[model samples]
Target: MSADLGWWGVPLAILAGTLRGSAPFLFVSLGECLTEKSGKINLGLEGSLLMGAMSAYAISYLTGSPWTGVIVAGIAGMALGGIHGWLAQQPRVNDVAVGIAMIIFGSGLAFFLGKPFIQPVAPQLPSIAFGSWSSSPQLESALRVSPLFILGVLIAPLMQWFFRSTRWGLLVRAVGDSPDAARAMGISIFKVRLLSIMVGSALAGVGGAFLSLYYPGSWTERISSGQGLMAVALVIFARWNPMQCLYASLLFGGAQAIGPALQSVGVDAYYYLFNASPYILTLLIMIITCSPKRTLTGVPGALGQTQE
Candidate 1:
């Protein structure tokens, strides 16, 4: 797969990597988007990601069903999210502090529980072979896409529409923008925020499943690699828009794919540097988006504010 394509392999590999790599980002960013849209930030999603990866791998190995693993992963994430939401709602408790604690707790729990399943082989999720029409094996392999990625793509637009046209979406927006106003309008701010966090966490868990069951395809202590943490920045870069999240995810995915893609074409001198591209890109994006002079459009008004 590495030697056959010469320079042409770079673009193809990037395309393939984008499809494969973006799913996790897409799911995580979307999850974070929902949470933030409801005026909450889930810094603990990294923990949820690791927990999901461990849970999915263990379940898949035991049940021989990848889909089951995905479900369990989502549940695990929801549980963590629920905990974060509940704790953050306490009077005088800071959500950011709660989020940080969840990160530690979730990741520690996952690492402890995952120790037993580290060596087990698990069933992998299936991919759609879009490259079947190609005569070249490399091309064929490159075009194989994950069903989860497709689902994320479809959900992005649906989320956009939901936010724009649905009454429930309006309620969520109202809560995020002004809890006092939402309360005045008879909305349960607590319930709305709690549900949003759980659903968002569930999506993050599915992203973790994608990592263990599809791409890297294994249970490991380091499976998440900060993708969950980076997702916060991604959501900001996307301006809380689901469709923009998709594009940003693809960009991040392509950046991630560059290192291995270059190595495949025999460019090894700068392999480590290439692999650092995603992190570097992340830093650049945060710097650009977090500029003090620029007002961030679409940021939830109540985001990061202390609740009375």
Candidate 2:
């Protein structure tokens, strides 16, 4: 019932966009989930993400390997996460304050280092063309799925299992739910929390790499576009479950695709307004789904506490 594409095609386009766009959300939220589950919070992941994007792009451009860039991005994120973890171990240091400082430092460092990379071209992550099986060229183009997305999907279940069955997962849960119990078991709180934060930061870095090296496929000052911060809210919305994070990320991705989907169907009025629809939708969903009662059920008990 349309010119370029039929009415049914619009939804399909949105579906494609959702899958493609959800990769960053999935990875970021998973990282946030991991961090929160370990009784620590890192608000500075936004900075880590930005820094990762910058480093990924710069490295890819310099080394001619996007995968290398992704690896470097993970390392960059881990470096920032390690710093946050180490500072949190200091006497009288607040995790939130340290996280904020890391954000400022990482962002400033990234901006300074990323100046020359703004205009340079970098290698992009490759995609698998699932649309090859389709008869439609549009479908084929839309079906070009990134391997990173598939990896994220796989990671969700793995994370869920990790928390449910693995010894490390039990330790993280113990540290999160009851620091005293973890200590009683002779577990080092500093080591567990620090390791969790580092892993979370590394995941976030890979998420950032997905942004610059895959989706928009470029380096810039604002490549992250606050995806890391949004992921914090998403983690809250998911109640800290990794599997829930996968679905929630898809919802967010679909919300983001609404604007572009409308434009593709010749409904481009107030494009900026449409662009902001994803945030609005995500907020509404969070408000609708979040229960005031039992609000803290899934929250880690020891989160944000300064242990003496």
Candidate 3:
């Protein structure tokens, strides 16, 4: 039932790829946004992602349930976040340096532990057949959607609302903007930041789980491909706005799909070039969004600074 739509299929393929590709970006960006909102930067999320992927894949292989793997992966990410948070709180410690160290630790740990899982198969996440109404088998198959993608879309608006309407959200913003003011107001800066980092790390882990358990659906050493780092740039580009993160994710997702879309259209030349599109696009986004003349509009105050 494999029918080709000729050159017309490229757009469809890209569209499908976008849906699949955007989920991880959306999740990771959202996680980083949360962490930055609390005035902390976690560069170690790249490691958290790898750890999450390996944990999820391994757990699923053992437990016979992908959801369990997802939950465990989140916990693993939280542990990493907790470690980073604790280390950052130590006297004279540098948050960025600790984060870099954590990244190495996380990656090394995952690599060592994940070795056993590389060859095993895990249960695949279930997808909704959104293309049920379509007669074209290719279109139908292309439209098969993961529930996680839908969840990410739903979470964006909620995050926006949470920041605008909730007391805790205001507290996080206050802490990020001015620690002195937050302390004067009787808010606990340490608690807020610690919790934020842990929650953000958990979200990143869930994103990792989505990568291994759902989309590409496997465990591997190179599974992340720097998606976590790309997310840092994405948060900056989005100006730390949750809603904007959704849009940015889609843009990145489309960029990632370009290579495969070209292949679908029989443009096999320079396949490596097409595959490099995502990284190249990341570079372009960073260059366009960052500037020397003006202060960034939405950067959290005290970001990357050691908290007292």
Candidate 4:
């Protein structure tokens, strides 16, 4: 692919990388989006992502079924999220503080438990070859897409619809926009927030599964590279909109692909620097979107607010 297209390979590789790399971002951002929409923030998804990766890899190795690994990973993430949710509900407790603790605890637990599975091989999730019709190997390789990625794509619109049209969605929105109003209407704020956090964390775990079972296809301590944390910034960038999260995730993925895409075309002079594009892009987005003078357009009103 690189030799055939020369400089053109950069864009093609980036497009391919966008499809491959964006899955994790997409899942994490969507998960975070759901959590934020229900009036909570979960910083522990970073830990969840790592735990999911480790658990998925270990489970796949043991069970010889990648799907089972994915399920276990989601369960692992849900456990961590459940802990955060329960602790946050305690009197005088801060959800953000609980989230931070979860990050430490989850990461440490994953690191401790994942040690033995580090060297084991696991079955990978299969891909659908979108480019099978093409004779060129590079094109075919570039177009080989993951089922999880496809699922993420479908989920974006579904989530958008869910938030717009469903009764449960309205309840979530009401809880996020004004907890007092939701409470006045007899909604159980604790249950809604807990469920949102758990569901979101499960999605984050699935994202982690994608990391181990698909792209890079291996278990590593640093596989996530802070993508879980970045999902928070991405949610803000997307204004808590599920469909917009998909676009923002793809942009991040493309940025991440720049370095390798360039390297594939023999442009390695600033490879490491290019690899930092996603982080740099994240920093820039945060700066631009989080300015005090610039009101965030679609932020949930109850976001970051402590439950009384």
TM-scores of the candidates are 0.94, 0.94, 0.94, 0.94
Report the C-alpha lDDT of model 4 over 1-308, residue by residue, as the tens digit.
Answer: 43478887888888988999999999989999999999899999988888999999999999999999999999998988898878877777788898889888888898899889888889999999999999888889999999989999999999999999999999999999999999999999999989999989989998999999999889988888788888877898888999999999999888888998888778879788899988788788777667677687889998887755
For model 1 the local lDDT of residue 108 reads 98
TM-score: model 3 vs. ground truth = 0.94
lDDT string for model 3 (1-308, tens) is 76769887877877788788888888888988999999889888888888999999999999999999989999999999999888887777888898899889999999999999999899978999999999998788779889988998998999899888999999999989898999999998889999999988888888889999988889889998888888877898899999999998988887787888788788999999988887787678778877898888888897877854
Which residue window of length 10 is worst by lDDT in model 3? 299-308
lDDT of each: 0.90, 0.87, 0.88, 0.89
Residues 1-308 of candidate 1 have per-residue lDDT tens digits of 44467899899888988988888899999999999999988888988989999999999999999999999999999999999888887777788898899889999999999999999799899999998998889889888998978998998999999899999899989999999999999999999999999999999999999999999889899988888988877998899999999989999998988998899778999788999998788778777668677698899999967676
Candidate 3 deviant stretches above 4 angstroms: 269-273, 279-294
User: Model 2, range 1-308, lDDT digits (tens) per residue?
Assistant: 12367566678867887878888889888988999999888888898888888999999999999899999999999999999989986878898898889889988999999999999899898999988987777788778989989999999999999999999999999999999999999999889988999989988888888999998788888777888888877898888999999998998887787787888778879989888977777778777776777565689998888866
- Measured over all alpha carbons after superposition, the RMSD of each candidate to the real structure, in angstroms, is 1.9, 2.1, 1.9, 2.0
Q: Which consecutive 10 residues in model 1 have the weakest lDDT in total?
A: 1-10
Model 1's alpha-carbon lDDT is 0.90
